[model samples]
Target: MKYISGIIAILLLSVFAACEDETKTCDSTLLSDLGMNFKKDTLQGFLVKDTIWPKVTLYAIGNDSVLINRQPRSSAFMPLDPLHDTCRFYLQLDSIAIPDTLTFRYKRVPSFVSPGCGFATFFSLDTVITTYNTIDSIHINNREVNSSNDTHISLYFIY
Candidate 1:
C-alpha cells in the first residue's frame, strides 16, 4: 500500500509539472508588414483609387513563395526583410508583357514590445524605385510601417 501511494503521488506531481505554463508565442499580427494599394487614373480628371488587378502575380525577388498569386487583388501586405536594408519584388500584371520591378529602400528599426512578444522590426521608407511597365508612378502614402492596416505605398497604373 505504501509503494502504491508513493507511485500515485509521483504520477500526480508529474501531471502538475506538465500543466505549468511555459509556452510563449509571438502574436502574428505584430509582424512588420508593408501594405500596398493600387490606383488608376481615370480619363475623367480624377484618380480611381483601389483599382483591382484582374490578374496579378507578386512575389519577393529572392523568395520562392508567391505573396499574391494570379488573382484579382486591389491591395497586398508583404513582409519586409528584417536583416536587409532593401527589399525587391516582382509585380506582373496580366496586360503587361514585361514585369515591373519594385525596389524599396528602408531602415529597419527593432522595437521591444514585451517579454512574451520578443521584438518587432519596424521600417521607415527612405525611397522607392520601380520600373515603369504597367505602373506609371509610385507614391509613398505613409513613410512609417509598423504592422498597421494602413497603406504605405500607393501604386498608380498607367491609363
Candidate 2:
C-alpha cells in the first residue's frame, strides 16, 4: 500500500510538471503577424468608424490558398510569412464586389526570446498599397508590427 501511494504521488507530480512546462511557450507567438482594422472614413478622415461588412473574405495570395471567408470582422489578426519580406492578401467585400488586392511591404526581424520560448518574427511596416476598386486607401497606422498588440494598418473602404 505504501509503495502504491508513493507511485501515485510521483505520477501526479509528473503530470502537473508537464502541464507547467507546456506554458513556457511565449504568448508573443499568438500575437498578430499583421493586425488590420477595417474602417470607413466618414467625411474623408474627419470621422472614422470601424466597419464590418457581412460578407468579407480574405485569402492568402499563394498556391497554398489559405482562406478566411464569410467572416464579418471589423479587425483581424492575420499571419504572414516570417521569412518573406512581402505579404499579399486578396480581399472581397461581397459576392458581387470586385476582389481587391492589398500588398504589404515590410522587413521581418527575428526576436531572440528565452531558450524555452525560442524565437519569433516581428515586422516593420514599410508601405501599404491596395487596388482602388472597393478599397479607397490603405495606411500604415503603426510602423512596427510586433507583440505590442497595436493595429498595424488601417484600410478604408469606399463608402
Candidate 3:
C-alpha cells in the first residue's frame, strides 16, 4: 500500500501545479510609427531614406503646446484614437519657418493583446492630410498600422 500512497501524492502534486495561473503579464506593440525626412520634390507614397532632419519640432494637437521642442531624430510612434477615428499632430519650428499640421483619419479596432496588457486600439489608415508649410509633402507608406516596429507615414520636409 506504500506504492499506492506515493502514486496518490504525486498525482495530487501534479493537480495543484496544473491549477496554478500560467498567464504572463501583457506588453503589446500596438503603436503607429511615423518617420521624417527632407524631400527636395514631392512624390506620392514616398519612402524616407537616410535623410534624417537635424531637428523637427513637435507639438501636441490637443493643447497646441510643444511636446518636443527639437526632436533630433526620426521615427516617432504616434498616438491613436482608441474610441474615435481621427488623430492630429502639429509641427512648428518658429516664426521664421512655417508650421505643419497633420491629420489622420483611420479605422480603430480594439486589440486585446493579453490579460495583463488588456485592450489597446489599433489603427488602419484611411486617409492622411497635411498642411503644406515648410513640409514639401506627406505620404502614407503603410495603411495597416500596428505596433510592429515599422513606419506608417513618411513626412518629407522641403530641402
Candidate 2, TM-score vs. the true structure?
0.76
lDDT of 3 by residue, 36-101 (tens): 334444344464454544566775477555656766555465666565788788876444577788
Q: What is the TM-score of each candidate against the true structure?
A: 0.76, 0.76, 0.68
Structure candidate 1, residue pairs in collision: none
Clashes of each: 0, 0, 1
Q: Global lDDT of each model?
A: 0.83, 0.78, 0.66
Would you list the rank order by lDDT, best first? Answer: 1, 2, 3
Candidate 1, residues 27-121: lDDT per residue as tens digits? 44576788998888776437475688888898999999998888888888888888899999999877454789999999999987555676789
State how far residue 53 of model 3 sits from its true place (Å): 2.7
How many steric clashes does model 2 contain?
0
- Please list the residue runs of candidate 1 whose C-alpha ends up more than 4 Å from where it truly belongs after superposition: 1-28, 95-97, 114-116
Which candidate number has the best lDDT? 1
Residue 81 CA displacement from its true place in model 3, Å:
2.7
